[model samples]
Target: MAKIAYILLCHKGPEAIIGQAEMLTAAGDYIAIHFDGRAKPEDFQQIKAALADNPNVTFARKRIKCGWGEWSLVQATLLAVEAAVQAFPRATHFYMLSGDCAAIKSARYAHDFLDAEDVDYIESFDYFDSDWIKTGMKEERLIYRHFFNERKHKWLFDTSFHLQQRFGLKRDIPHDIQVQIGSQWWCLRRRTVEWILDFTRKRRDVMRFFRTTWIPDETFFQTVVRHLVPDSEIRTRTLTFLMFTEYGMPQTFYNDHYDLLLGQDFLFARKISPEAIELKQRLGALYSNDKAEFKISNEGTSLFKFLTGRGRIGRRFASRFWETESTLGRQRELMIVICKKWHVAKRLLEQIRQVTNVPAIEYLFNEEHTDLPDLGGIQTSLGKRTRHRRALMRMLFDYYETDQMIVCMDPSALDLLQDFASDRSTTRMLEVQCVFSDEYLIGHAMRVGLAGEQTSAETLERLLPTIRGDMTFESDKIRDAEFEHHYIINEARDAEENAAPLSNFLDISHDKARQIAQSDHLFAD
Candidate 1:
C-alpha cells in the first residue's frame, strides 16, 4: 500500500511548506500541494521549485480562494486528493495535511500504524436533530456560509435533517463540528476516499447542497461521511503530525502546557521566526536542508495501505463517537477541577503569568458563581442584567434558554464549546457543572433550579428538564436535604449577599459570563 501526504495551503508560508516537503520526503510519502491562489507569486514559485526534486509532488490546477466556513478549502482538498490518486496510482492511503503541519511520526512508523489499525479515518456522523432541517437551517448554518451559493446550500439543510432521524443521532446538536471530530484533518484509506468521491458524484443532492452552505468544508465532509458510511470502523482522530504556524494553529485551552509538552516530545522549542529558512530547524529541531529523495510503499504490497475489513464490502460503518461519549464527559470533569483548583482559566492567563506579569486574581474565578468573595481589595460583579433573569441566570442561558442547545455529551463536546467562544466561558460552565457531577448534587442543583436562581418565570421553563434529568424516585432523603440546604441558602437574607453556591470558587458559572467573556471583561470594577 502506498501512502500520500496531501497538504492544503493558502497565502502564508513558503519556508514552512518547503520544510513540510522535506518531512514528507523523510516519511517516504508522496506529496500533493494545493495553493489557494492567494499566495504571492514568488512564494508559490519557490515552493514549486523546492519540491521539484521529488517526482511525487503534484500541485492542483484549480486554485480556490481560501476562507473559513467556505468550500474553497474543502474543494482544494478534494482537488489535491484527485491529483494524488492520479499521479501516484499505487498510493493506498491519503493523509490530509496543512502546509504548516509537520508529521509527528516517521513515514515508516505512520504507515505501519495505519496498517495495524485496519481502519480508514474519516468523519461520518449526524450533527443535528430532525426538526433542525426545517427552521433549523438558519440556526445550524448561522456561522459561516457566506462563500456558499444559495442554491447549493439546500442540500446541506436536507442532509443535516436526514442524518439526524435516519442515522440514529442523539438529541441536541452543538455549535461546532470540528470539535466533534477531534481533528480537522485525517488519514483516509484509498477505498474510503474513493467511496467518498463516488458518493459525491452519485448523490447529486449532496453535491448540490455542499455547493452553497456556510462552512461547507465542515458540513460537506461530515454530512457525506455520515450518510455513506455511518458504521465504518475508523479511528476518529490520528495524532496531528504536521506543525502549524501561529496563525494556522487551531486555538487551544491548555496551549502553554500543551506547547511545552509537544515541544519537548518533538524536540523543538518555539515557532520559528520569519527569518528562519526552515521550520523544525529554525525552531531548533533536528532537520535536514539538502535535496531529499522520496519513496512510498508500492500501492498493493506496503504496510501503510492495508485496508480495514479486507474482505468486507459494505459502507455501514459506525463512527467512534458512540464509544467516546462517557470518556469525554469524565475528561471535562477533570479540566473543570484544573480550572477551579489550579487557577488557570485559559492559555492567555497562563501565558501572562508565565511571562511574569500579574493578572488580577478575579480572572481565575471568572467561571465561578458571581456572588462569590472579593479579590484583593475590591468586590465586584461582572455580570449583565437580562430582561427576565438576573446576572446569575444569564451564563447558563446557552444551554438553559434554548431547548435546541446541543449537548456534546462527549469529551470533544467541551472542546467544541470552547472553539465557539473566544475565551473560556465554556470551561467555566463545565467546571460549574463539575460540582454537580454527583447524583445528589446534580439532582439537587436541577431541582432547586441551582438554588432558586431558576425561580424567575422566564427561567422556570428551562429549569424543568434539569430537575427531571437529575432527580429519581428512590432518593427522597438526598432530595429533601438538598431542598432544605437550598432553602437555607436562598431564605437567609445573606443569600443574595453571599449567594455564591458554587463549592469551588475557581469554577464559577454565573449568568452574564458569556457577556463578560465577549467583552473580555474579566476584572470587575
Candidate 2:
C-alpha cells in the first residue's frame, strides 16, 4: 500500500476542514495542517482538539501569517510539508490542498490511482503561454516590486506599479531559470517534494527574487518543479477541481454542482463554502463507505426515524431497500450511457435499468430537458451541447468508485449494449469493444456523436475497452488499474482503419492520450 501525506493550508471554516480531514483519514495517510498565523489561536486549538485522537494528524509548529499572493502562503505550505515529511519518513507522496477543498472520491480509489502512476501530477504551463491568461499579462506581478502589506501601503504600491508601467521600465526576469505558473494545489511524489525543499534551501536568490515579486505562491513551486523535472515526467494536471467565473474568481461550489463534482475524475474539489452544509454532509456520507471493500448490513436504524424517533425498523428496512434498488441490488457492475438527445438516453437507460441489476446506472446527457424521470443515477446537463460530452465522460471515469465493471454507450448503440448485457458471459466480467459505423463515415459520425467535432485517437482508443470486454479477475488489480472498470465506446474500428485525415489529425501517442483523457474538454468545440 502507498502512504500519502496531505498538507492542508487552512484559515477558516474549522468544522468544514475537520469534515474533510475525517473523510480522507485512512491507514498510511498523514494529515499535516497549518493554521494561518492571522487566524485566531483559539480556533486553531479547537481544531487541534477535534483531531487530537488521530495519530496520523499533525500540526505545523511554525505558522505563517498567510496572505493571498504573498510569500507567507508559500511559507505555511513549506512548513506543513516539512512537518509531514519529518513525521512520516516513508510517505510516498505529498498532496497540497486548501481548507475549502474536500475529497470527492474514496481514499482507497485515490491510493490505488496514485500508486499506479509514476509521474508527478502538477499543473504547470509556460508563463508566456497564450492560455495562461485571458485578459492580458500583469507585468507588475513579475517585473515590479509590490509590498505585501496591501492594507497599509495600498496607495503607495498602486502608484509605484503604475509609475513603473508608465515609464516602460520593467525588472528583468531571471535569465538562468525559466518561469512557470499554474494552480497552487498539486500532488507530488516524496522524492519530488524533497527535491523542491532542497532546491529552495540551496537557492536563496530564487527565494529573494520571488519574495518581492507578486503572487509568488503560484509561480515559485511551478517554476522550480518545471526546471528540475522532464516534461515527460510531469503531468500538467492537478487532481483538484476548480471552476472559475467570467470575472476570474474561484466559483463557490453548491448543491447544484454535486453531480458535476462526482462526475469529474478528480480526488478533491475546492471553494466549498461553510453555508453549503447540505452539500458537505452529502459528500461526507457518500465517501464514508468508499473503502477497500464493500460491506453490506441490515444493521442501523432508518435515518428519518433516527431523526424523528417515530418509526425505526420498518423505515430502516425501507431505506436499505431503496439503497439496494438504486445501486442495482448492490451487484457492483455499473453501466453509464452517454447521449446527446435526452429522450434517446432516457429510453435506453430505462430499458437497461429494468432488465439488468447492474449495481449502478448513470446517464451522462448533453442537453437538459423537462419531464425526465428520476431514473435512479441519471445525470443531466453534463454539458450544454454534444461538444461537451467528452468533458462529461472524463468526469464519469475520474470519480468512479465501484469495484465492478463499467460500460458506456451511445444511445444509437443501445442494441449492441442490450446484446452485450443479455449475454451473461460478456457482462459478467470486464470487457472492451471498439464499434465501427458501417454506413456513415466513422470520423464524421464521431464528430457528430461526441461534443467536440474532433476526438483524439488516443481518447477513442481508451474508450474501446469499455464497449468490448476486458476483465480484471483480482480485486487488487482492479483497484490498482488506471482505468480498471470503465467501458468507453466510440464510433471507430481498429487503429489502422482510423488512420484517415481527421483521425490522423487527432492521432496522438499513448502518453499524449492519457493526458488528453484527463483534461476538461468543456471549451472544446
Highest TM-score scorer: 2
lDDT minimum window of 10 residues, candidate 2: 321-330
Residues 415-497 of candidate 2 have per-residue lDDT tens digits of 34433344322233222222323222334346557424466666666655443232222223323443322333222333233
Q: Give lDDT tens digits, candidate 1, residues 47-78.
A: 88888888868887677756444667678888
TM-score of each: 0.43, 0.54
The TM-score measured for candidate 1 stands at: 0.43
Model 2 TM-score on a 0 to 1 scale:
0.54
Which residue runs does candidate 1 get wrong by more than 4 Å? 123-125, 129-139, 142-183, 230-232, 241-279, 282-525
Q: Evaluate all candidate structures by whole-model CA lDDT and list the values in order.
A: 0.42, 0.58
